[model samples]
Target: MLKKEQFLSYSAGAIVAGMYCGKLELNGDFFAGYEYGTGISPSLDPYFRSEMKRLEKEAEGDLKSYCSLARLMFYKGNKPKPLVAPLLIDKP
Candidate 1:
């Protein structure tokens, strides 16, 4: 059986997929105007930052490094725009 956090992670991924494909309504506490890639708060979670730091070190290749930088910008906000935006798809 999946652990609680693992289940939630899968469920959240499913929700994101559904929303992106226009199968789900974008109405929720989680959906708050980060759609058009704006309004992200700059408050970085300490634990998340630490985890990212570890992952960043493990990350290989320029693309991986770029993706890490994009994720960091996503959480902390207000950095220069990434060369390619993070893979989050918006509603059509």
Candidate 2:
């Protein structure tokens, strides 16, 4: 028997996976965009900022940290650029 929050967490993860699966191939920045977009929001700025403060006092996972950091990385209305993937190197 799954708890309500646990079930919701799994469902949320699945939904996010589905939404970004295609974009993953299309844009290298897909994951970064998703992290920043979902984690940090103008609507939730106060909450996010507070959560960040709490996290700073007691650091949370990478997702929210990325968004909190994004605030410092970019100006309002300007999104930080996506991180590029390293090229594959064939072993000799």
Candidate 3:
């Protein structure tokens, strides 16, 4: 019986760890290129855009709604259907 805060912390930790490994995909190219002004390949733009649009619709374009949905997904033993994980490591 984990407390609410603890559960949130653990869920976040799991997401981080998953991102650290290769099991999960990185959140977005903007994050990947934070230090540099780069992004996903132009060829992949359409695919990424469509995926984001789908997620946006799911969240009703609201940040709070998106977060709540993401948390619920985590609680329900499912990863949020969005590229929400943050980059955990940088590769050379």
Tell me each candidate's RMSD, in Å, in order: 13.7, 15.1, 14.4
Candidate 1: the clashing residue pairs are none
TM-score of each: 0.25, 0.25, 0.30
Error of 2 at 7 (Å): 0.4
What are the per-residue Cα lDDT tens digits for candidate 3 across 25-87? 333442435323432242244544454445545445465555544544332224443233333
- Tens-digit lDDT track for model 1 on 1-92? 33333333323433333333332222333334332244332223344344444444443335444444444332222346423222232334
What is the lDDT for 15 in model 2?
Answer: 27
Error of 3 at 90 (Å): 20
Candidate 3 CA-lDDT value:
0.39
Predicted structure 2: lDDT: 0.32
Number of clashes found in candidate 2? 0
The positional error of residue 64 in candidate 2, measured at the CA in angstroms, is 17
Candidate No. with top TM-score: 3
